[model samples]
Target: MSVLSDLKTVAVHRDFRKLFAVRLVSQCGDGMFQAGLATLFFFNPQNLATAAAVAGAFAILLLPFTLVAPFAGPLLDRWRRRQVLLGGNAIRVVLTLVLAVIMVTQGVSVAVYVLALVTLGVNRFLLAALSAGLPRVVPREQLLMANTLTPTLGAVSAVAGAGLGFLIGAISPAGVLKDGLTLTVAAVLFGCASALALRLGKDQLGPDRAATGRGRSWAEVAQDLRATAVDMADGARYLVRRRTPGMGLGVMAIHRFLYGVNFIALILISRNLLNDPADAGAGLATFGLLAGLSFAGNGLAIVLTPLAHERVRPSQWIVVCLLIGAVSQGLLAITPAFAMIVASAVLLGLSVQGAKIAVDTIVQRDTHDAFRGRAFSLYDMLYNAAFAGAAALAAAVLPDEGWSALVFAVLALVYVLLAVGYRAGIARIDDTPREVPVPQPLDEPTDLV
Candidate 1:
């Protein structure tokens, strides 16, 4: 069904509406909070002029929490999801306020970084809770529609929040005050989200006692952690046995690595090359415009991907995306003109989003239901780590101004190689019969939480 039809069908459910509100409001806050951070870290005249500095900032904020994410799943499964949503947003409200204060008083510092990490870490759990609790509120028949609508609308809300932050920044004088005010707005929204969470019953979003059993002892929790490690290893082995999905995952990592380098370059280019470094407001405005264009490219991909799929297999579609990425980077390699850069941003956005959609389809289609969760967990790890690794590589090679023809050329070549290699690898894999498990009843709600 069309997205609009799905929304109309699912909006009849009151609980779904409540949970949806929580998602929209909280994600909106997340967007504003991230916008504030971006200004402070990348666009500010006094902070992060060099690629290395930018790389350091990303590593400090992203890596530690990423490593800890898998462990959060087990805890999320144990906690009452309603409480998780309420408490998570409530905690974020407090942390964001404190972070705003630190940003205003001390500017960017180790303390600011640490607090940001904690705040973002809390956000991770909240997001997971939202996903896990989804099954509880929506009927099994409508789960797919609910899933589709929630994430898409949540993303739109986030973009709106970022736009609001930009508007606030544009009105306020550029500096710590602008960032602090943006964060303050984010904190208020977070509090609003927390209040909305109160509308759900304490156990409405549940790990139903029957499904989860009694609370685990410390030893049991440790054992579960150990078992999770083993399960992850098994999932890796399963992917290795299933060559198509494995290649898809590898291709995604390569794409993300290259895309991450491009992202870092764009930030530096927008901050220093496109605008005067001394004029922080101008740099922020330029970056914001480019970012909106990139998001516009993402919207275009939403339209283009299905059309491409009608003509080609998911695997072939990935090649098309990689080639598009190659051409975009190739343009940048030839020239760093503002117009070319703008076009490149739109194209790369299309390329990245298109590839990701194809990869997600391949993974889900090929992976067994039992291993799908682990497969996605692995995907998430690679997704974040690849970008972090790319930042480190960019720091080594990219200049302070972020204009490097050689880097762009290398990126273009890598994209081409990845496309060729991925296509060939998948082409050679023989079709093998796999076990097809019996389908479960849709009427029964899954105990995913």
Candidate 2:
């Protein structure tokens, strides 16, 4: 089906509509917050920076939450996911408010960094909860459409939010105050997300009582922690047993890693190479343009993914995405022109979003709810870790100008190798269709609070 048709069909599902609203609002807030941070760190005239510093910023923003993933998964499975969505967004609002204050008063410092870390950590948890909750609202057959729409639209919402934030920045008095003001706007949007989440009942999205444990004594707490560690490991084992989701995750991880490398490279090139370094506004404008173009590509993927999936299996689609990545990398390596880089951004966005939709469906379909939270937490971890690792790697190799032919060549080689390895290793499985049971909701709804 076309994107519009799929959306029209799903839009009538009441529960899904609410869940989609939460996703849309929350991601839009995320986009605004992220743009605020970008402006504060890289785009600010005063913050003339080094590659390592840039990498460190990425690390500070993403890695801490990744470290928490192993434990977070079990809680996601243990706690009511709706509660996580509600409470997480609430905390995020508070954090965003605090972050805004710090940006205004503390400027760039450890305090602001600390607050940002916690905020992002909570944001990651909220996202995992949403992914885990998805099967609760939609049928298994529509998993592809569900994944395609929720995340794709959520991404577009985020881009729109970023654009809105930028617009605010443009009109406001140009100074530290503007960045803080933009983040304050993000806080308000997060508050709206909290409100939207409240529309869902406590048990509406769940690891049902049978799947979750109740409170226990101190000794039980220790035992529970031990069990959580074991369960986290079991989650890994579970994925290994389900070769399809495992392979899908592997593809997702590789794509994210490459995406991260390109991300940092894009920042460097835009800030220092493509635009005049001394003209901070020009640099910011160039990077913003690339970001907007990439977002446009992401929007395009919403239509492209389902169509491609009709003709090819998801795993095969992944290979096609990796091939596109290789070609994009090759273009960047040779010319390094602004036009080529912009095209590369678009290609990367399309390929990444397309692969992600396929992978989300595979994982959601293959993994049961009992372990789905953990499965997605691992998914989040791999995605973020690859991204952080890429930034670290780029820091080591990329020049201030961010124009590195060697890095581009290496990235292209990795994509090609991953594509070949996937074809040999996983895609070698028989292409026979498997029966998919239509997933039911976790529980009948209780009264909305």
Candidate 3:
């Protein structure tokens, strides 16, 4: 059966379908905005300057999440999960709509852009809550499928959204009236998607609050903070204490750090550095193509990994892929040529996606439902921090010539070492390679909380 068929079989019986639908909508809007924003900045009078500023702004937004995400688990534990998810989306929807409006109004300012980026970071934190909520909606056996599918479909949506963005931006007249209509329509879609995600039912969200009397003092809030600190420490300890989880997280973090560079480097390559002014549009077009293709390669792994991992040790696969990534990053470092770089990007795509899948599957298999949310979210926060830092550094430090690509290569090489040292006993599943089990209809609700 196709990967879609597999995911559908899981979705049909559980709350996963509901959550997945919400993810799809949210991802679509985000993808559109990312593509549209980059293209818009490219055309703006202060193109390079604003573009670089936006990258730094996004990095700032991400830093707060890294510092604050550990606190969210307790909030999520105490509050209604569904409401938390919905409210987060609501904030994000407004932020995104504002962005669309600012562009159409020709009133774009770096301040407003930075504010929107921060708002999206908050929204993304709530997304972490939503991720935690998933295992509660499905059976243990299907968690991997559900987790993989969410990101896979999200990557696919990004590709489609980028296309939609490019076609609309490229093909449509920039007259205020026409641009207004499109922005208005996209805003409406963003709103609807937020509402859909907000519809997380009360039954699923109903975690019992601790009784108010004794624990309600001002000191208790401090105590609560302390308790969260302890939990976070334990969670960190849990991840690092184990050979597999620690190794897996390290490799994945490196993947994200380089991937962030890949994103920014593409823009610099296609839009700024190319020599053939006549081919500027083509170069940028290929940038989008290569980027979307990398993500497409990511989505493809939802199917391919079942076969690929069966053929080789997951650790060996990760190191080999990282080595390949280092080569491509090195190639990109030296060349100003567009086509050669785009070809190199394709190889980078394959390497990054494979490493990501290997790391995630290994960790998830070792984790239990109770701590997975906090554990995974913590890992995610670390990875996002690395990614955000890399993005900012790419913006601030990239040489007029060979900066980001070389940095990317060095980062990939570090992961190559981590992957090589990964304890094989930890990352491997001992079963004979066989057809993946089709999830029985999601007949039962899992208490991920």
Candidate 4:
């Protein structure tokens, strides 16, 4: 069914509608909050001029959460999801306000970073609650459609919020005031999201006592955490046995790593190479434009991926996408001209999204339902860690301006090698018939965030 039709079908569920509203509003605020941070970290004349500084910022924001994600599921299950949605956004509203005050008064500092970290961490719980609660609101028949519609629309809302934030920041004078004002707007939206969450009943989004049993004690929670590590290891072993999905995961990680490096490079190039180092506002605007173009390319991939599947196998499609990435990076290696960079952004965006779609399908198609959650948990960890690792690599190699033809050339070569290697690996695996494991019910409900 079409996306619009799916939305229309799910709109009849009042509870789903309420939950959807919360997700859309909260994610929009998320985008606005991120935009404010980007200005403060990347486009501000006084902050983050070097690649190392940018890398440090990414490490501070992303690495900690990547490490904590596995344990989050147990904690999330303890809370009433309705309260999680409400309290989480309410917490963010306060945190964002405090962050704005700090930006406006004291300027960027350790306090600001710590607050941002906490705010974003709360956001992770809110998102997990949304996904976990989804099954409770929608009928099993419509659940798939609801899943497809909600996240897609939420992403659109986020992009709209980001564009709005960028415009608001662009109009204001550069510095703390601009960032503070933008964050203030985000805080307001977060407040709205929190208010919306109140519309849902305390027990509406639930852990369902029958399903989860009694709440665990602190000791039991600790035990659960320990078991999570074992569960993850078991999932890894399963993937190794089912070579195709494991290889696919590896390829996706490589892609994410390379893409993350280019992302940091894009920021530096936009800030120092494309615009005057002192003209922070112009740099912000240029980056916004390029980012929008990149998102446009991502949107195009949504249309193209299914078409490609009809013509070639998903594995082959991955190779094509990787080659496309190589071509995109090669453009920058040839020249860092603004126009060439713009084109590269679009192509690279397409390549990343296209490859991701193919790999996601491969993982889902090959993984057993019993191990699916763990497989994706590992996927999420690799996704964030690869990007963080790439940021570190970029810091070590990229210059202050982020214009390194040598780095671009190396990235392009790596992309080509990854493509060739993945294709050959898939060819070898295709000849061997792999046994599919019988799915078993889990002892406890698994959170599939």
Candidate 5:
């Protein structure tokens, strides 16, 4: 089916509409919140001066969530997903308000970092709920379309939110008030997301009875740390048992690790190399413009991925994207010019989003519904942890100018290695089963059991 037809068919579902609304609003808020924080941490003259600071800020904001995923996945599998969405958004609303207040009063202090960590932790939960809930909303056949729409639109919403936040900061007075007000706007968006989430029924998005009993108590759902870790290990073992998902995840994790390095590079290049060091606003604007261009790539992915899946095998397509990443990174390393950086950003965005869609589909298709939550939670954990590890490495080596040809070369080599390694790993599957089985129409069993 064409994109328009798929969208028209899916959009008519009341529950999907509500869930999509929640995603859109929540992501927009996330965009604004991130922009506010980025400005405060990386673009402000008083705050951001070194690559080490940039890496520290990334760790401070993201690493805590990696710690939270074990507990989060188990809880998601036990609790009603709709309620999780509602409560997560509500918590985000409260946390964002608190963050705004902190931005106003204290700037980017330890208190702000702690609060941001909590807010991000909540966000990870909310996203996992949305992903888990998606299969329940639409028919199995349209899963590809649904995945394309929800995440791509949600990302566009986030980029729009970031742009709006940048606009607000640009117009407002400099310093604490600007970042504070931007975060406040994000809080309002999160509030709207919380309200929208209320429209869904309690059990609308589910952990089926097989996964969790109808009357699973909140206390039981609140599994202890040890139990959560054990569950996470179980999920890991499950992925290991399924060769395709495990291999696909490795491909994605490597891409994320390299992409994480690219992320810090872009920020530093914009803040120091691409723009005048003294003019932080100019630097922020440069980075924002590049981000917008990258989102353009995201838009192309949303439109192209489903269509591409029609002709290209997911595994092969992932290898193709990785090769693209290698080429992009290699070119950027050869000459870190502003124009080259912009082009690299677009290719990187396309490469990442393309690979991500393939991996997401693989996980959802191969993992049964009972284990989907845990599977995705592990995905999230690896995704962020890779980025955090990259940032830590970048902090140690990347200079203030962000022009490290050797680092870029290393990243390019890693992408090449992952692509080649992934291709070889999947050779046996291609020769035999050829492809993982996706869920068919209701006339056919999903094999979900």
Candidate 6:
């Protein structure tokens, strides 16, 4: 009962409530649509054209980040965060509505799919903005725990959505139109999320934005960033001068690289081996349940992490998680049954969440708040971009082998490399000791449950 009471308290924290609801709605909507997508792709012969259309849509919608993220970094201070959050949700609303229309209309052309994907991708940009905004609302001490909760919610939402979808799908026939209906439900929740973002006043978080001597022209902003990185050479040099917090960037870099490969591996596994038209739908449904279980583990971690902070070193856990991931992939490859596959997913989830919590704790504990969001955003972009590139490369190179073997091999290489590298990185760290400047308990006494 005390444990249950504690969870309720954490859930009620005003900031967590607002952020968690928004992420849950958006992810739920995505899950529904994702299930809808699989059903349409594998089962329907006529709508085969729509698969490429959706892929094209993703390509179009996600361009905002590549184009605007750098500029947004500077404006992160200037723009009203509430408005940014609202804007992102509002864009998703528009996208979802149009998507619903396309789903309902038989005459809807391939262009509709493209538009929807792009719009959804744009909505994801808002996701990043929200993540950046979160640290401001929550105390620095609760940051890692707070961060974990959202992913945990996202996991739960995936399960709920998948269950809802399977139920809806049981009644409705497979098609783009059916998929759109599921999306519409999520869109309504997304709109509610937008309203919530708007209601959450911005001033509570840190300085709204630092005054950058009157805004620079677009070209001028670009020039300033280029020069800024160059100037940071001194700071960079200082960082490397003797390890400490300096290697935070290195850890982030490697973590992102490995994560990129993992994302690609998931894609190949789903698209290839999971292709049986019948299995495709069930796989999506079950994957959500498995993912939910993963998030539950993550939530448990969030609840328990600060208490364990002294015991769980980021470097130590990073190495352990990498090994776990490698072994899980091997397990996944050999597992013939659906139930076994899920067990493998749960293990992978545990390892992934643990490593992420530890690394994020390390970064936030060591870096000042001023550069925090920008540093995170930059890291996110690189890692995500790497995900696409790795997926594409894997797609091209592993044309023959089954996705299971391909996925296993990729995981094997990644974990093996990471484990080896961390060993070397750690030894080099002892020699340099200055690189990881702050290796201490990350939680604040006041903030812990």
lDDT of each: 0.78, 0.83, 0.62, 0.78, 0.81, 0.55
The lowest-lDDT stretch of 10 consecutive residues in candidate 3 is 431-440
Candidate 5 structure lDDT: 0.81
| Two-way TM-score contest, 1 vs 3, winner | 1
Candidate 2's C-alpha runs over 4 A off are: 174-176, 209-220, 431-449
Give me the candidate number with maximum lDDT: 2
lDDT of 1 by residue, 80-159 (tens): 67877888899998999998898788877888989998998788777767766776787875654464457556776888
Cα RMSDs of all predictions? 4.5, 3.2, 6.2, 4.3, 4.7, 6.8
Query: Tens digits of per-residue lDDT for model 6 on 255-303?
Result: 5555544444443344334554235444444444555665565555555
lDDT tens readout by residue for model 2, 192-257: 998998898788788863233455689988997898898788887777766788778887897898
TM-score of each: 0.82, 0.93, 0.79, 0.82, 0.91, 0.74
Who is ahead in TM-score, 2 or 5?
2
Q: What is the Å distance of residue 342 in model 6 from its true position?
A: 2.8
lDDT by residue (77-166, candidate 4, tens digit) is 444667777777888989999999998899878999999988877776676667667767888766544544565567667878998888
Least well predicted 10-residue stretch by lDDT in candidate 1 = 438-447
For all candidates, the clash counts are: 0, 0, 0, 0, 0, 12
Kindly provide the TM-score of model 3 when superposed on the true structure, using C-alpha atoms: 0.79
Alpha-carbon lDDT of model 6? 0.55
Note the residue pairs that clash in candidate 5: none
In candidate 1, residue 100 scores what lDDT?
89
